[model samples]
Target: MEKNKQPKLINPAELFDPGPYGFSHSIAVESPSTMCFISGQSGGVGENHVLADDFKTQVQDALKNLHIVLQSHSMTFENIVKITLLIVDHNQEKLEIWAEEARNVWKSSFLPTSTLIPVSQLALPGMLFEIDAIAVKQLAN
Candidate 1:
């Protein structure tokens, strides 16, 4: 990969396309790059850490929070190579909502590879979803 080359998202011909499910099969990134591992972000808003009751709202807020963290590092969603989602009491409806929300955020055909884990609970109460990401930015030198 050349300098400033974005990571390559690979969805093998044999494997099914995961974009509709909010992920990719794999991502390949070359070195001479900076990799940022963002911590889990919940749907909490403001200094008080208020959480939304609904899953969809929580997913949206969590994505926004993740973007804020990425922005702090001078990066954006395009830099993301992988993500992990933790959903409380996850179900079909929740999956659909996640897929919709993810498609809304990621517009390109290539998307970050992701793993979704269904959990019984989270660190904060009323937290329905949490997302963590690994982003890579190629260096100029």
Candidate 2:
């Protein structure tokens, strides 16, 4: 009689449903090969670091900071699986405008799972928004 052989198991991240809200509940849940957690990235650095006081400039700077953190770990925006955004003032118009900027940066790639939280203010008085993210590197077979 020949012995029976078992197949190997494979696991990958999966997004959960968020019901009729039209958005997913969870982003991904898989045993990550490597996980990276980026700190909340703000628009400016030092007291005199304020570049562009406008919303568009702040958005651009935040994205640039995100890229810097990703680059430090040999990754890019495409590798990001989830993101959390904190906005100082919550408005549909502002969100729409910010979406445009985000689209310009992300391009045609699939948008990462995200959450936008409206807040009264940030740690810094002049700060308008802050963004944070989580990413995982898929292992090669």
Candidate 3:
């Protein structure tokens, strides 16, 4: 028996185009049993928070925090279907660095749908980047 063998759900092909310029190969869930919406995460480590002004460092910290949140629900990046990245200064170099980090974290098995947005500023004055994610747990029938 297959896990996602239910009938009444919207098909992925109808909801999203599989081949698009910026779209990934991830399938959007029709209806998920559990959904996790993570808040925008930054690179700050402490309670008072000393954020790294560097873009790569900020990306790293944000990914780390994302991992922690997913782990709490016994989930991993593989379960993540969508991710939105907000950057204060979006650049080719920063994107390259982020791609490298993403490869390390997500590995080859799963590549979640993603979106990157360049913003003028964030909530924090010195914050360079912020990342938020949406994950759904695929349960067996």
The runs of at least 3 residues in candidate 1 whose Cα sits more than 4 Å from the true structure, single-residue gaps closed, are 1-31
User: lDDT scores for all predictions?
Assistant: 0.79, 0.66, 0.71
Sequence-dependent TM-score of model 2: 0.71
Question: Please, what are the lDDT tens digits per residue for candidate 3 over residues 9-112?
Answer: 21122122323434332322335455666656677655454788798998898887777667765678887888999988798998999999999898877798
- Please list all clashing residue pairs in model 3, or write none if there are none: none
Q: Name the runs in model 3 displaced over 4 angstroms.
A: 1-32
Over 1-141, each residue of candidate 1 has an lDDT whose tens digit, in order, gives: 576767655443433334665765345455777777766777877656678889999899888877777766667899998999999999999999999999998999879999999999997778899898898888898
Better of 1 and 3 by lDDT: 1
Task: Give lDDT for model 1.
Answer: 0.79
What TM-score would every model get versus the actual structure? 0.77, 0.71, 0.74
- lDDT (10s digit) by residue, model 2, range 5-124: 222111111211223434321133234244566666667643354646776678788787777667655667887878999988879877986798788867867778999999998866
Q: Residue 1's C-alpha lDDT in candidate 2? A: 16
Residue range with the least summed lDDT across 10 consecutive positions in model 2: 7-16
Give me the candidate number with maximum lDDT: 1
